[model samples]
Target: MLMFASSRVGSVSAGRISNWIGHRYTIVVASTIFLLGSVLMGYAHAYAVLMAGRCIAGVGVDFSLMIAPVYSPKISSPSSRGFLTSLPELCISFGILLGYISNYLFGKLSLKLGWRLMLGIATVPSLALALGVHRMPESPRWLVMQGRL
Candidate 1:
């Protein structure tokens, strides 16, 4: 529930963030935040810290969700826009599937490490995204809007 609420708030504010920083950077930022949350959750010794990590991760999720739909269209050619726009949803489904599988596999470990492994594993992907996003082109539309082009 806390995650849900935080995501809603993040979704509401993501447009402003995207406008200010551009979609590419927004994704990088979101991924970084997600990474932080994952690390926090993985190492958390207290309930409050765990919930806080969850909320932070929720915000990152919402930011990615909000930006991807808008960003995809801007980056795609008209002919490919429909297909590209669907990729985010598909990727999300894939991630969820992976998460379930990992949870099951990790659950076999000792209780102290099982959940931590499950949560901490997310940081790998988040770190990848944060590092890789810089190689991608910024949205042309966003660039134009920002008067950078």
Candidate 2:
């Protein structure tokens, strides 16, 4: 619940910040925050700490969700932009399905370790996203907005 609330707020603010800076940097920031949140949740010693981590992760999730569609179309060729823009939504659905599968697999382990692993696993992809985006060109629309084009 708290996570969802924070995500809503974060998405709105992230849009404004993305416009000021650029989508690439914004996504990097989002991934970093998500990584931190995942780590925090995995190591949480109390309910409060877990909730705090969830809230942070929520914001990160929303930021990525809000920006990916905008960023993909801006960088893709017109003929492919429709497919590229839709990828985010498709990926999100797949991610949720994966999460459920992960939970089922992890549930067989000891409670303490299983849940931690489930939460921490998210950091792997977030780290990859943070690193991978660095090599990609910035959205052309953002470059034009910055008067670089």
Candidate 3:
């Protein structure tokens, strides 16, 4: 519930953050936060720690979710805007499918190790996004908004 609740709050506030810091920075920040949360959850030994990690990861999830569609259209060519904008949702659905598969595979492992591995695996994509964001161009609209265009 904390995850869903935090996502609602984060989704609501994401636009303000992107407006202030721009899309690239927002994505990097979101991924970094998620990476931290994943690490915390993977290592968490207490219920409180697990909940805190879930809340943090939730915020990160929503921030990225809100910004990606908005950013995609800005960065792509006009001809590809629709397709590009849809990619985020497609990727999310794919990720969910992968999660289900991973859950099934991990479910066979010892209980403690299985859960931690599932949570810890999330850090891979978050870390990848954090590192890879530096290579992505900033949204042209955002650059205009910042007077950097």
Q: Give each model a TM-score.
A: 0.94, 0.95, 0.94
Worst 10 residues of 3 by lDDT: 1-10
Write out the backbone clash pairs for model 1.
none
lDDT of 3 at 7: 76
Model 2, poorest ten-residue lDDT window?
1-10
Q: Write the per-residue lDDT of candidate 3 for residues 28-110, one digit (tens) a residue.
A: 98998889889999999999999899999988898898898888898889899889988998999999999999989999999
Which segments of candidate 3 are over 4 A away from where they belong?
Answer: none
Clashing pairs in 3: none
Error of 1 at 30 (Å): 0.7
Specify the highest-TM-score model's number: 2
**Whole-model lDDT values for every prediction:** 0.90, 0.90, 0.90
RMSD of 3: 1.2
Clashing pairs in 2: none
**Per-residue lDDT of model 2, residues 14-112, tens digit only:** 889898889999999899989988999999999999998888888888889888888999888999988998899999899999999999999999998
Candidate 1 lDDT trough over 10 residues, lowest sum? 1-10
